[model samples]
Target: MSSKRRVASGAVLAALAVAQGVLAAPGAAAEPDTAEAAPARIHEIQGTTRLSPLEGDRVRVDAVVTATRTFGSSRGFWIQDPRPDDDPRTSEGLFVFTGRTTPALTQGDVVTVEGTVAEYYPGDPATTAAQSTTELVKAHWTVTARGARVPEALALGPGTVPDALTASPGGSIEHAPLRPDEYALDFWEAHEGELVSVIDARLVSRSTDYNELYVTTKPQQNPSARGGTVYLGYDRPNTGILKIESLIPFSQRPFPKADTGDTLTGVTSGPVEYDSYGGYTLMASVLGEVKGNGLEREVTRAQLRGELAVATYNVENLSAVDGEEKFAALAEGVVSNLASPDILTLEEIQDDNGPKGAGDGVTSADETLRRFTEAIEAAGGPRYEWRQIDPQDGADGGQPGGNIRMGFLFNPERVRFVDREGVDATTPVAVERDRRGARLSVSPGRIDPQHPAWEDSRKPLVGEFVFKGRTVFVVANHFASKGGDQPVHGRFQPPARTSEQQRVQQATVVRDFVDDLLAVDRRANVVVAGDLNDFPFSPTLRELTRGGTLRSLMDTLPESERYSYVYEGNSQVLDHVLVSRGPRRVSYDVVHINAEFADQASDHDPQIVRFVPR
Candidate 1:
């Protein structure tokens, strides 16, 4: 809590000197001007004694860290003292010893810590009182420290747990997989509703969005299983599950709320769960005293003023080919043909090698998207950032040159590519024509399967965009074929007929994902659009549009202009734009653009949709 807890000493200077000799110029003399300067200010202590001299009451200590050592704690041994004393006797019972310091500390490192001077207390190991300190006990530790180091990591002192239970055998409980009895309370007054820290209590029950926070005075020793009190914490926003770790009362001491400073209150229900659909997170929860910040309010173009514009275009197989001008032409066509929407939803982008393949013939997912981005930027459009899952070359029925994929392109000026959600649907196997169609195995050269799920499947691309002063959700999907074979029904129809089954399944997943999102808040503005590979009369499309009043941009066209890809000799509208609600119907249109391009980059025509929200 004090600014003085950031000072460095001469030991740092000596260390830097030795470091320079080892890391800097070998034969040439080092220049003084090039040397780092010492900080003008020194770290100092800020102390305030509490009326109750308990173990976890944070104090202030302004001293230089001479050494760092890890010792056994109630949980297990971890990096403890940044600087340990040579005479353990003198250092013992100092009350105020350093716990964890971010940016780490080294020998002779100077730092000023403002935290509780913890003292060991006696207790039993069986009861909550014996297990650890109770919420009312005021034996919980509070810490806040700042220092200079290579890589900073938060540290916890012995006082992290109540002194009473910490000394008992099978001591302070490890808070991993949080126990039900170990709950936490966050104080947000200092941050004006921004949660500062928490007081760990016990959990009574759990729900989809919220949980009950209660104080535990004793531990429950299960003779049949590993023993410890149940703790509580969650990560989902909106639906509130208290994040115990996030609320650990480490820094922001002095209690953010004046009334809550020492008072131990209980909120019967609190936010606990956050459901993620597509790329958006829906946080749901119940609060005790504080009311909602209208977080459930829907974000739309009207709320975003005129800064947001909804644009969609179907880019036919934007795949890269080595030594072929078509690859460069394809990239150029995507940037040139499509209207630049603040957030552009693209369809039929090819992933030949991986997700984003090299246009130069090599199968590389990163290369394909990289070229597409470069082409967009080169075409006088805003910098284009995108998200896609690179599949292995020949995985599934991927494009020949690279892994042809579906994705979205956004102008960073309007929206920065924060992160993506969902898993990749692409496989990593080489081209192995097995009897059971094409079986996909993991490819060694493609993206390592060890990464997160989102990187594997290119099915759905999730991204965040800042518009109308609120975050808007964007999801791009390319459903499976509608006429594919349906082995599930024992119906040996054409590949096209069976394709509908996979399409329905994919749509169901999308619908369920969207339903989960709407459950958190009904007003969320979501757009599910792309070359569905299915027609309007199909059952899969009907299922997706059933509950939420889905609006199709293609419906606005004069039926003739709605088709995206022309098959056989028949011209039918396959591409579409589906919104949450069809407002005025007059406010949406599907522009037939690619039909006019003489080069006709790919077989599929790019469909454009413009929507004006009322």
Candidate 2:
């Protein structure tokens, strides 16, 4: 709505916009559907559903330019009808993608445009599917009038969105008639491309490095104690959570950089758009400043000298060559926040050269662990000795050369690692019993590395540790990531969890291994921990803790506090610690140090469990 507003779309939208049209002649890209080809108004083009009824049809329309991107990869302008459309179901605005070419007009400039209506699905095919934004691609326009008043932004508040997440159950809601009063998806669809604003909204999550953040209009929604809309269930995606994408470039007015529980002071206005990252987004023309709520990082109580404290952390692809600051901060979290757990299971420890940065086909993480352990010692923590079996070069799934794998770090002063030879990446750890009862055949060994469940994924690292003269079997895991799962708010209701099958397989392998330990000794001190990468409510967890051989530490916490990760705005658990029947008394914590903060060393929050072995 402002002439000075600049468009700063995300990399996903920017790339998709370039895919809309590259200007190989003005109308060269249009492949009009045989259904129709005629002049249409904004409402007619947008229709009354989630998708445009006239999509894929070439049409002509006249409207005023509301916003424009003169630079960047997504060079496009937003156009909207000044006149009223009485139907509350249809939007009055549309995006005109000009590809690499910048628009020649400013805000309030009326224009007549002809183009093919298209639906632009952001991100690549691999990204979780979500609602798409309707666009006018391969366009040509001419100025009809200048200095016309810009359309006023529609005010959105808590009352604007329906408490319901969607109207259709897991089916394509594209044909469903608009029920803006009953469903949030429909309400957002009704206002698609229309300039909208939310005043003084509460930030639900921390602002990303891109200066983007999610805010909630509903204060009473399923909120976390630390001021976040907890994604309690797949059906309970908070309707009030709105993603604010900065339209004003950082050079002009930077996006508010704040943590969760912060507030967006003043008006935040923008056009409603959809993307893969955050389903419904408000591309802001008017940016809001952040008022800090002072949500601080949490510090767990240090374990007693006699207690065995084990922690699991996914350092987020840490090989991490240029991560001096990151390494220091992570070490500080281990020392100050996590209280320097005796045994730490680190996931995503990349190879020596960082993510895809390695040459000579190196896969070992000697340098990576060396730097991380040194940092921990410098941060007033004990020298942590580490052990891990290196995976075959380029065998793991993460960034190609990253060779990400799970490793263990233990304080020799607090605990002693039981050494066993013949442990390699492919060698599976086995439970062997002799005169001294059950013990590991190979310490620092892998569990079923050659199993199909571990194909292209990090193998579970199994180790033996002795604390207070008691042997403890620790299985550290970094299961397959949730990369391919369809979003909960995707077009398909109850979006399919395609990535879950792999995690389930990995869980079965880990569960069976735990069962093997329990089989050899009925009361073995065993701890299973690491980045499970699945929620507590998932089938993967159900299968992993089957037979009750290992009980998840998350089950020990209150329902609201069972989270170690915050995704979008949902406070949920991905990392977990589970103990066997041998630990008579246990205390577990999902240390809230990183996941909710804007300044984070890792995307995941490390979780620790302390117990006295039998």
Candidate 3:
């Protein structure tokens, strides 16, 4: 007889009938010989959130099957005790791994399982350092009954969830369950691997590449004016957010494209587990209806009278390979959305051949810029002129192949480039003053090109332009990226910001140069803009504006409205426009085009500011 038939008779058969909660077979009321023979509760096998105390020990548990995954590397079913334990820290649910074999059981069916408890790590156990999940391995089970009751899912949200996942100074998870009610990491640690639900939660960020959505039950702290959350400071905590992972098992394409402020109703049920990539996530088995509203494309603001408009945009490594479609969309955004600004500071402009040619050490970007300018004109914009200095091969760090650099695009009809002698990739420009005011010695030159801070980074491109008979000195920068910095959700507590030191040095060099320009002419019309790759409150920004010679235009807007980039769920400011004392009462705005949408043309939203030169 098969294992299924052998377990479906005598005492096992009677117990299976009684587990149904409806009918009682003969001799179903008979008790076991001793209390030790009775099955253990599910919570006992899952003592704490981190690890089970009874791992590797043989035990028997009686639980109702809640969910099952029949195909996959980790094929398994979740079983939960109908009657939960008194301690909230202990989870009443446990996963039973059956490998390739399908267990002879159905949802809501009561069964008695005998197995050895083990802690399983998803990835390689040797290298990756993360918490392990408790499971019942090499298990055999007999159906105790059918139609058993399933435990109600515990609702998780604010007040019930903690504020932040890691402690400050050192980003690490607390293991002692201290302040479990106040910290999200602690709160989630207490309820690991338990059946959970999030009802009527609103999406806080767009769906990720892995088809995950971040949602919150209450309004997120430090909410941006454009309907996203902001990272206040290093000390401030961000709590009350949950990651919804893998919406339903075996369902093709579970996640739907959603924007911030969209509502998700219905009882979204799942098992809470620690995901290596996403921190604590609810591997959901069921998702409710997604209501998408309150999201629309933002319109361009009208240009101010007598004020020259200057814009900064990171095109996300645009090259000739981006093809005509992307270039057209980008042109539409520049012409229609940016109102054909007089001067445009651009970053991430690739070499002429894009990534492919960049690998062969080709440095000319003339073809790339020409194609983009043509596209802009075709989209009904001004015939613009461009200027830039190609970096030494492999000196500027970015994607290994794509040699990215900073450049400028100005409407020649609106502004004139003030050219001077002796400007090249290696030569540094200096601030000079005539009877009129401060001007660049070299119209299109680099600032401190040989500075150690710019060793492997894109050198700052300084250009001198005259708008309506007034000279405006513009500095285009693409500072060191935060490539090596540890993720805020990673294992390290207060993840290390390794790239900050280099950015600080870069900012200092630029700040000193700006000071020199101001000293020559305190009222110099200087507009410094591009992807600074740092936050407004970061030490890097403070170093740049230490003497108050330059002020961030973002500071002029409401704190909630100052953002140009979004990562995870935090809307942050990586690009900025800082003006010297000359440009007064500048009107600045972060145009809502990209960063918030999945189909966005670029990863960053362009920023536009208009000011009348003094």
Candidate 4:
């Protein structure tokens, strides 16, 4: 949610206590400066490239403080030069990181300070890669004057930012000179650390728990059906989206609560700064009043009597320790919104003591299922009997100790689960044929669990169920996440999806499973569903739907309505329900329950496909 304005702890420090008069900033202000020079302008310090040419050299600048954070992890002040420069390539504003000193400064306070030019990255390079923020660290300060003339903030609008989201696709643009007129990243880079404004701001996504929200200056740039940005392709990533991190103290004004389609009906002024979350962000000091758009969560119509309603939901690391309120809200979403699916495949089911149980050698999730099913029954929904294969404790790569795995919950009255011989976590589930047609070697088993693609990831849980005397082969999946992927607005122009190939490998594994089932019986009633954490247009999806064996329900909907998850400001698909050609008539929906709301039971929206198996 944050660009992580607060810095790392292993910084150089020759200063005093971290919190003397203000809160300790993210970087514990460690670097000390001994070099001093004549007054230098801000633009000269900010070169055309991402890294400043003057970095590591001590220089002074006379500028007015545009904003101040005397408290919190980013306790420092932002200053911009009043004099205008002809070159649009260099920025006139700068951020002074107050390491240990709580410099008493106010907005519009003129100051001349000497400091070392340093490029700071919020995260460790050994684990995560993040963009660097140019800062004037380790300083000697002098108050030049108070209440000086501050430059008018640059107005950012649809016309100002480039329509092109990037200049290079999957290539580094760090050395590229500023091309402000041609690219969005370049435009923001030219105005880095400078005050900017957005009028009639629309909050595209829900305000995060950290009080951070994404706003768009261009609302018409590939707008989604639900009044949000649409991420159509790797090239067209909705360049209008810009993140906002409030600098205003929470005590002064709590960040306004807002969801998708809500508008901040005035000017939102803030300094443009770079962070790793989603690149350039509006470090908003002035916020507008939020106007409600009356956007509500969507509901999918319940399946007909002849239809077998199957759904997939990621319960976001659900465990027995979760609060009753959370369980009840989730149950309500299923009952009222989803109208209670017949067979639900749940992902991220943790153990009895939540994630901690894995470390404590307690891996059973019987209690977690008990609480969830009871909550569903309490909410006036059907009593769903559950099935799951517990993974090796602490083997899955989710939370440190959370051994999350995929599970199933089926309504006994509506459908019957076929319980055959099962295999452990490392064993595989193979397809076999008998006189009664294709059948699983073991019912409710995992597909190729020992494959390298399943290493440190959840294996695909394949379940066989009978609805109206016909067998339905459903494979529920929670593939490798998109964690290691670079930010869309990152230094790599198109941004690298290092986590993508793993998903592709996982998708290929699942695709082969579906193909094998269809090979035995061409008209196999197979459905592949779950949090396959990638976009609908991604290679992962293409692989899953390859060879015409399985068809993605995502292709059935209009482009505007094909989203199941919202990222930053873009409404995109990260969850999907795919089926074989066996079902002639199929109705599918990416239900809107949690992603668009601020108070969500889960971060993901549960999706369902209704069809009658032939």
Model 2, residue 76: C-alpha shift (Å): 1.9
Model 4 clash pairs are: 6-26, 7-26, 7-27, 12-30, 13-30, 25-73, 170-494
Where is model 4 more than 4 Å wrong at Cα? 1-32, 124-129, 169-171
Assess every candidate by TM-score: 0.40, 0.90, 0.85, 0.93
What is the per-residue lDDT of model 3 for residues 327-440, given as tens digits with 9 covering 90 to 100?
888898899888888899999999887778645878878888999999999999999999998887778888767789998999898889888978877889998878887888
lDDT agreement with native, every candidate: 0.36, 0.81, 0.76, 0.81
- Which residue pairs of candidate 2 clash? 170-493
Off by over 4 Å in 1: 1-307, 322-337, 351-364, 392-396, 420-458, 482-496, 582-587, 596-598, 611-614
Instruction: Residues 1-614, candidate 4: write the lDDT tens digits.
Output: 00112111221121111222233222223565666565688888888877788888888776677887666766677888766477788888889998656667777666666788888777773344465677798875655455555667777777878888657744677778887878778778778888888888888898887777888889888787887887788757688898888888789898888888898788888888887876789998898888989888888898899999999998898999999998999899888888899999999998888866557877788999999999999999999999888888877778767788899999999999988875677778889998868988887898888888988899899989999999999899999898888887777656678898999999999999888888899988999999999988899999988888788898888888878778878888888999999985899988888998888999998999999998
Task: Kindly report which residue stretches of model 2 are placed more than 4 angstroms away from their true locations once superposed.
Answer: 1-38, 123-128, 168-171, 356-359
Candidate 2's TM-score reads 0.90
Per model, state how many residue pairs clash. Answer: 86, 1, 13, 7
Q: Pairing residues by index, what is the TM-score of model 1? A: 0.40
Write the residue-wise lDDT of candidate 2 on 220-263 in tens digits. 88778788877666556678888888877677775667888899
lDDT of 1 by residue, 1-614 (tens): 10011222444434433322232222111111222222211111101111112334333333333222222122100112223233211111121222232223332333333333222222322321211111111111211222423111111111222211111123222222221112121111001111112223222111111221212222231110111121111121111122221121224322121110011233322111111111111111112232211111111222133544555556556554333454555455445544456676666666544334334444445665677777666766667777665544544243444455556677767655544233444332122233422211321112223323223233554444555444445557666543323211010111125456666766676666556445544545556767677777677778778775466666655533445543211235566677664222224444433332223445555544444322
Name the weakest run of 10 consecutive residues (lDDT summed) in model 4. Answer: 1-10
